[model samples]
Target: MKRFATLMLAFALVLGAISGAQAATIKAKGQWAFDFSWLDSGDFTSQDDDGNSDDDFSASQRFRTQVDVIASEALKGVVFFEVGTTVWGRTDGALGTDGKSVEVRRSYIDWIVPNTDVKVRMGLQGLSLPGAVAPSSMVFDDDVAGLTVSYAINDNVGVTALWARPVDASGNEGSDNNTYDEVDMFALVVPVTLDGFKITPYGAYASVGKDANFTGVTNGGAEFLSGMLSMTEFANGAIDSSSSTYDAWWGGAAFEMTYFAPFSLKMDAVYGSKTADDDAESAERSGWIVAALAEYKLDMVTPGILAWYGSGEDDDLDNGSERMPSVSPTGWGVTSFGYPGSVYRQDTYFGLNGAGTWAVGLQLADISFMENLSHVFRLVYMKGTNDADVIKNNAGVRDAFTPGNTYVFLTDEDSAIEVNFDTTYKIYENLSLVVEMGWIKLDMDEDTWADQDFSDAKKLVFNFVYDF
Candidate 1:
């Protein structure tokens, strides 16, 4: 706490001194937000049996605050600072044990170039891929010290290049002791406009430290190095290794077009691949996701339809191969709507999602009822093909166990019907009260182990903001 205070004080002093010399204008912005949620469950455990466990209930709360300062034209620079904290929680083991603590979320600076379409930004900043909605399989939101440069090639096209570190070290549970030095990121984004429609195409690559061991054996094992150099020997030996690092790359193209007739459309396709180092006996895996959304605007309501399809890697047994795993939400990635246990990854040669596979859904209405109040209602359903069971038992028996001692199971046919309602009212020009209610039902085949039932989850939030 003292360290944080001291850092803030020092930053303020530096800013004051710089501004006083140049007679620059000083602008400040701040925001505060609070969120609370309640949950009701019936047999929420990930176990396979419909055990008559107790019907449990729990609630949690969170708070966040941020401040930013911008220098005047004379100084030609911008500075930002953010801090957030979770106030209460009992649903998760980590949060339930030790309470929350406040910590710095972001601090960054930017300097505008004197001429041309170029600017340099350094310090902590947010990173996102080029997509309307991030894939549930890919992680989102990394904060790192980096720089970005933008250039306007012409009236219709622009490009941006960026480099940053991989770190999401916010003051949250599981964030302590998180460190990475050999990991780096780079990206290129290009936007072109034509006939009132914009097309964005981007690509990004990350090279992380070597942490994945593909040999199926640890360094202490005699067969470890042998497994890496020769897959034939690896197949014959008993291999077990710790997690290591490697390089991962992703690229995508997207189009957003709007006609003057009150309708807009968005579509995107992305491909991701991971390359392991020599010590890791793992094979290169690749996957892709395609999504499309169309929306029509009415006087008081908007309606939209969304469709998404994701393909997993093919299984190759001869190469000591397995299907590529879906990405997990370790930090601020995609979150489950109301599922009981944390949904990590899905296995399939093609069509796998954190929620499910090959989802075709529609949202009927998003309406504004009264002044400063609105409502959103959506109905979406997903289906899985070559499904994979996510639950694991103590004995390591799965829906389908591979000869290599890997568990690759499939879920029976499953579906979820969800309805969400949200309302917001302004308390002042910059403050508001927000409330959301969600009801979900999971339907699965009788033999499946999931808690196939219906339930309601509620969230209430209040926020105050002064934007510059």
Candidate 2:
């Protein structure tokens, strides 16, 4: 009751301030989306060896809405607030019961400096890397109380600096594990444009609290309880006795150029390092992915292809030693399922993901047939190389790695292919309908784990969006 009263009081104050302000423009925007999906088999396969099939057909539906409010010059300084909520249930195990549960996604105040190209922003906001890799889809909004400053050196070159305290370490989220007090992140970005070419060089540093260790172990055919017992040792080894701090830094550059009219190329690369603050234990991890894309505008159609490679880090299998292992959710041939924040990592803390190894893949997206109707269509495909040692080990049974251990598990190296078709059509002036179909194939030489023969999987999804 007290919390509700406080909220009501706050809303009243906002309304009163708006009413008393001088005549000035205020702007507001909102979006509401509903997504539905049906899976041929919800059971993707588990590490348990109970011989019980985990694959089962299932479907889900979800509704998400976001609202943004901006108070213009009437308030002297611009104040913005954004909130999001889930309005429906999803069959996927990830989403919880939903009915207007609102969360603040962004709330900040921008103070403009008269004639200079400088502004100071404070309050909870989003921190994003300049590159597309770390965009909203991959890394959700990191709620932090921070300050940002930007300067326009010239028409072509601009710079920005930011510092923030991550919400996780700020005790704002209310977690029992509060051993680490705070996290500090800083980044610098400089963008320049010359003729038809543009380049941006960026650098970022972050000091993350390290109270736990990251470990990954395979259960082989063992039950979940047995696998947990065997994996305890690896988890215990990743902890540092001293200050318990993990320091990480990353730097990268991106370039885009247009050689011919209507045709352009894009590429980006990043390198990163993670080490303990006290130096009692340290590991060097770095990888770079490069992609080249070409696009030609044909009225309303745009198509492009991309090729990329990453040297993923190896897992630390032995104390003070590391082995090249495939990471989960994104390593080898696995693609993460579920939406942002709800997604789960195979191994949360300890894994061989920090060791530098290599992976190559390609992707293609095209927009076809958009005319007369308010609809657009798109298609995408991707593939990558797999690690032999990582796949052969089969999660733990030593015998599984022997020459006779020819049983190929679901993690075995094989070509993975995914095909997707999506379309969106306007139903009204502010509402639209979306439909999508996706198919995945894993061409394996032999089946080792699930007695069932290996083949392919398919899924279908639909969505409706309303904009205001």
Cα misplacement distance, residue 450 of candidate 2 (Å): 9.7
Task: Find the 10 residues in a row with the least total lDDT in model 1.
Answer: 341-350
Q: Over the stretch 222-337, how does candidate 1's per-residue lDDT look in tens digits?
A: 21122121222234342222224455677777777786558988777776665555545444444566777788989888888877665522233234222222222222111124
For every model shown, the clashing-pair count is 18, 13
- Each candidate: RMSD: 9.7, 8.8
Candidate 1 wrong stretches, greater than 4 Å: 1-24, 46-66, 72-84, 88-100, 133-139, 167-181, 212-245, 279-283, 313-356, 385-412, 445-468
- Global lDDT of each model? 0.47, 0.44
